[model samples]
Target: MTDTTDTAKCPACPGRRHPRQYLCNTCWRSLPSTTRGRLARRDARAFQRLRELHRALAARTPLAIIRVSR
Candidate 1:
């Protein structure tokens, strides 16, 4: 299979590059509205969940704790 995608530079990391990535979907979706501006309410929820997971991992909490509610 062949992929026809253009490489795009990640907005957050100029030195790093991605193929056909726009704001690198993961970062785009994770970005808080306060940082990115005017995000849908649903996207905000997803962003919050991402932050919570990050916080838990940073605090060395077990993955079990993070997955309990999910």
Candidate 2:
């Protein structure tokens, strides 16, 4: 038997996240387009940028105000 209910908690809200996603749909859509673009990029610095996003979220920064370095 396999567990299909494997989901992770959203960092920004109480919503659940799909295994391969960083945030819930609502929270992901709430982010600014620029930030979203930056986060979508997969490069050598991708993990660093993700950490920046997580740090900002941990600080309770608004999604609109969140910025990840290029």
Candidate 3:
């Protein structure tokens, strides 16, 4: 079985991310509240929203400037 406790590197920075999470604490906290709220929602569009976040991050977009569509 896979280790659920393993830590992974954060995509936005060199910080360590907890297992099953997308970003490290610092990086996550840096995101705008609206973005965080949208990401927290568990709905059919959740995956698509996550893709938007990841795409922004991959493009080196600033956390405060990142916006996800509904």
Candidate 4:
């Protein structure tokens, strides 16, 4: 029998997606910053959520630099 638990495709793209979500990574990443599309307006929260994740990934650790001098 086929595995019925497999996730389904994203509504905006042709990629499998999380069961609880309607968007795949590709769609999430491709979402425009401005709400100019019909789908974008409907999935605004998902787009914003992915945007935050992207931002967090792009952020860097602010480690202090030290120098030892004689």
Candidate 5:
């Protein structure tokens, strides 16, 4: 038998849950206001989606982010 419920450690912050979120709370907080504004302005929907995807990645949700146009 094996224990599979262990939470993975964050690459940037050892022994932490990595915030299990987009860019991690620390990184997100550290981002420059200008950068945040830029990200907010360009493709707001895509940016929001990216954040969700990043959260999924942090949780090992087995998902990928891609772009498509029609």
Candidate 6:
């Protein structure tokens, strides 16, 4: 058996690289955004939720704070 695929060196560090990937898993998600003009998954999800809330408010929907756990 043998393994063959394209690979690239991660600019963050030098070591094992993944196929067809510029950065390793650690280095890839280690930063805020994996690439430019991109938002982190968590951030993107939060923005979506905020947009929904704004839309509801514009539509005259009442919003209340049931609880503030944070």
Task: List, residue by residue over 1-70, the lDDT tens digit for candidate 4.
Answer: 2533777655544567776653566655554434223223434365564454344334631111111111
- In model 6, the clashing pairs are none
Q: Candidate 3: what lDDT?
A: 0.86
Residue-pair clashes per candidate, as listed?
A: 0, 0, 0, 0, 0, 0
Pairs in clash, predicted candidate 2: none
Candidate 3, poorest ten consecutive residues by summed lDDT: 1-10
lDDT of 3 by residue, 1-70 (tens): 3543688878889877896677888988999989988888889999999899999998999988888876
The collision pairs in model 4 are none
Off by over 4 Å in 3: 1-4
Candidate 6 ranges with C-alpha deviation above 4 Å: 1-6, 33-70
Clash count in backbone of candidate 6? 0
Among all windows of 10 consecutive residues in model 5, the one with the lowest summed lDDT is 61-70
Per-candidate TM-score against the hidden true structure: 0.34, 0.87, 0.84, 0.37, 0.30, 0.34
Please write out the lDDT profile of model 6 over residues 3-70, one tens digit for every residue.
33555555445654576554467654553332212322345354554354345435644333211111
| Model 1 agreement with the true structure over 1-70: per-residue lDDT tens digits | 2333555655443433356333456555555445334222345365675565456546766443332112
Error of 1 at 33 (Å): 27
RMSD of each: 10.9, 2.5, 2.5, 15.3, 9.6, 15.6
Q: Name the top TM-score candidate.
A: 2
> Model 5's lDDT to the true fold?
0.42
Candidate 5 local lDDT, 1-70, one digit each (tens): 1322434444334433333333445544544554444434546465565565455546654222221221
Give lDDT for model 2: 0.88
Candidate 5's clash total is 0
Global fold similarity of model 2 (TM-score): 0.87
